[model samples]
Structures are given as structure tokens and as C-alpha cells.
Target: MAPYEVLYGRKCLTPLYWTELSEKQIHGVALVRETEEKVKVIRDCLKAASDRQKPYAYLKRKEIEFQIGAKVFLKVSPWKKILRFGRKGKLSPRFIGSYEVIERIGPVAYRLALPTELERIHDVCFMCRCCDDIVLIIHM
Candidate 1:
């Protein structure tokens, strides 16, 4: 268990934790607090140090080289079913199909050409470079 002060300061929680807090009112507050405390500690340590040189490291945008006709599987996130009177709807499969890369918009983001069925549902979906899960960017 973390201290109360420490539990008062986090930016975000893990994806697994979202389910745990679905029914709770003040969900993730404790985790946020803990994150804040950790940040405070880091800040204090940095202030005490005379040398304030190197900046924080972050992921740099990598150059993506892919052809327009590259066939890539677009990952999708799970849909949460609403429970009404103890009845639930079936959840759709996470990744529906492999989409052809229509165009490269940005380093990480891309414009995909999906099937007609999926096309009727969504326009463009965002691809996760790290994970296999893809999210529906927008419905067209």
C-alpha cells in the first residue's frame, strides 16, 4: 500500500484498472494522488541537485517506411457491453480484419482502406504500433 500523500498524485491508471473502477464513484483518485507524490519527490530531488542539465527522455517519432499497398492487420479495442436487468449483449471481436495501407498520414498515424462492411461502420482507425489492438478512429 502507498502513503496517502503519495496516493494523491498520478496522471493516469493502467487499462486493467478501468474495469475495477467501472462501478465506483471516486475511481482512480487514490492512484492519481500516489503519482503526484512521486512527481513531487522527483522535483525535490532535482531542485537539490546543482546540475540541472539533461532533460527528460521521451519517445521520438520514428520514420515509418511502408508501401501504399502494404497489408496490415488493424487492431481494435474491446467493446464494453451494457448490462441492463442482468442481460448483456455479445462483445465484438477486437480486431476485425486486415486493412490495406491506403496512405501514410503521419509517422505513427495512417489512413487505411477497410472492407465495405467495416467501411459502413467506421471511416479510419488508429493503429497501435506497440500493441496488436486497434481503435476505431471515427465512424463514417
Candidate 2:
């Protein structure tokens, strides 16, 4: 039984049947055809929406890779009342380095030669958090 039949003690009215109808009044073959048509229409609409969204989802994304010994700027997240590398405030820089890439830990992670001040923090960072020093010119 459908949830509506269990909860309200009656079958729910669908788009095809706004009024209550007995099982004898509806034919199985016709109901199956209508349901298949509705499902096809819903699937087509979902595909259209997904296609329209695909380009924007990848607009700013590109494959990023770095070799060992390459220089990169590491992105930093600021926290309230907590200092990072002795810098704090709304005006502080969002990224720090030209840190050398010591090793490529994985496809998307790189280990950097961070300064002694940042020894407490982990050295491995994802590609998104590290920007190539050469590409920094494009933004300027």
C-alpha cells in the first residue's frame, strides 16, 4: 500500500485522476502506459538541466600538476584571534610562499618545504591550495 493509503485510509489522487476511482474503474494497461510516458518526460527534463549546468560546473577548473623543486604560493585560511606565521587581520595576505615543492605526495597532494615558523603545520597540501608561481602573472 502507498503511504497515503496507510496514513489517510484512502488512495491518493494523482495528476491523472483528480477524483477518487475504484480499482475496477482503472485498467492496468492504460495506467502502465501513462506512467511510462510521465517517467520519460521527467527523465528528459533532468537530462536537459544536467547538460545546461555542466559547463558552469567546470568553468574555473583545469588540470593542475607540479614537479618537484617547482615554486608555488600556498593558500592560507585565517581564523579569529589565532595567528598564522605571525600574520593576522582583514588586510593580511591570503597566500604565502614561493615555497619549493619538496615532493609530489600523490596525484593531487604535494609536500612543500615550508618555513621553520610553520613546522607545526602539516607539509602536504592539495593542488587547489597551491598555485604555481608562474601562473600568478595571469591574475595580475
Candidate 3:
């Protein structure tokens, strides 16, 4: 069944195909009250569904926090047929630099001490673009 049919308790009808079938018709105050009741039922159902799914949506989410002066690697994505950080293709590095966090701009944003090569790009980046673990080798 369509979602509209289930929620509204009736199939949606186009104006061209619509016809009055019942001899008795609801009018005035009763019609208003009936419409309000249907709207209330739909709202209740929507709220219930949202509550049930909220937990599952947040199940894998972890709140990350970074401190000032901590080292973090910046994640970089290289586009196809384009050069990024003087490198391109499948063999290009996924992440670059263990840049130091100069300051925490907000809960999820931090200012990094980016190298001169990345001067054109913004120094501040979101927490999702950074990783605290020293996984990549620092070839200095």
C-alpha cells in the first residue's frame, strides 16, 4: 500500500476521477473536527517513527574532540585527471602531514599549522578530515 493511503486511511483521488458515493455527507463543525482528527493521527504516527529510528541513526556516531598542540593527519582526496599537492593518480597519498593543531575554533573545527605547500588552502578544517593516530610514515 502507498504511504499516503496508510497514513490518511484512504487512497488519493484525482479531481477528474473523484465522485460523491455516500448519500449522507459530513458538513459544518463535524467536517472540521474529522479533518483535525486525521491530521492529529498522521502527526502522532510520524513522531512515533522518528523516535524509534533516532537511536539507530546515532548508534555508530562517536563525538571526537581534539586538544590544542596535538598532532593530527589531514585527510586529502585527489580527483581524477587533476593534480593535488603536486601528485595525482591511484598511487597518490590519501592523507598528508601530521600538522599541529594551533587552536580549536569550535567543537568540530580546528586551526592547523599547514605547511607552505598548502598555503593556498584554508588552514582550518573539520575534525572528520583529521586523524590522531600516527599511521602514515613521516618521510622527512
Candidate 4:
């Protein structure tokens, strides 16, 4: 059986089985046992695939850790908080604030000390937007 059938607990009807009919003799406890075995096999295969692909996924990625009081710029997602009161969002800067990191909520989330002006938005933000150096002046 394919992994799809094993995980989803359903038989896949493909062109290979177009002319075949399901065996009606297998029933009751036997059918339940068969399904259980398929589920076990599916779990093992999924874990193996994840282990094999994990290293490649992190090849070029660098993990960044933020400490309390560290300054970071909050990314401006156009969908998250709309700023189109009167001006166009395309003309607005893509990022806002060099806010200080006030608290760590979880492994990947942080709470920033946003200004009173930005009290409307949520305090918690992901680490992907926590950049230290806003811009390094490159001397031409």
C-alpha cells in the first residue's frame, strides 16, 4: 500500500487497479489489524524523511538569539496593520521602529517595547524581523 493510504486510512484507486475488485473476505478484527500496521509504517517513513531533509533545510540559515533591551526594527506587513489613513502604503517605508526587546515570550517570539503611539498593535513579534544593524554605511 502507498504511504498516502497508510496515513489517511483509505485505499487509493489508481489506473493499476482499474479492473480489480476489493477482497470481501477480509473483515472484522483482521481489517483493523491491517489498518494499524499501515499506520505504523506510515509514521516510520515520515520520521525518516524528516530526519534526512532537516540538515539541507538549515544549510544557509543562521539562527539569531535576542536578549532583553536589544534594539530591533519591526517589519511592516501591509496586511497585518494597515497604515492607509490617507497616504498610499506603497509609498510608506517597509519597516518601522528600532524598538527595544522587553521580554521573551517563547523560543521564537519576543515582546517589544513599542511606543505609546503604536499601542494598538500586538507586542509579540517573531524573531525573523529582529535585525540588529539597521544599515551599515558603505563608503563608496
Compose the digit string of candidate 3's lDDT tens values, residues 8-94.
998887432233436466455755666677778889999999999999999998767778887777766556114664556676766
Better of 2 and 3 by TM-score: 3
Pairs of colliding residues, candidate 2: none
User: TM-score per candidate, in order?
Assistant: 0.36, 0.46, 0.47, 0.56
lDDT value for candidate 3? 0.69
Residues 86-116, model 4: lDDT tens digits? 3345765455667788888787678998777
Candidates sorted on TM-score, descending: 4, 3, 2, 1
Worst 10 residues of 3 by lDDT: 14-23
After superposition, which runs of candidate 4 have C-alpha atoms over 4 Å from their true positions? 1-22, 76-78, 81-95, 105-109, 128-140
- Per-model CA lDDT versus the true structure: 0.54, 0.70, 0.69, 0.67
lDDT of 2: 0.70
Lowest summed lDDT window (length 10), candidate 1: 79-88
List where candidate 1 sits over 4 angstroms from the true fold. 1-65, 80-93, 128-140
Error of 3 at 121 (Å): 1.5
Q: TM-score: which candidate is best?
A: 4
TM-score of 4: 0.56
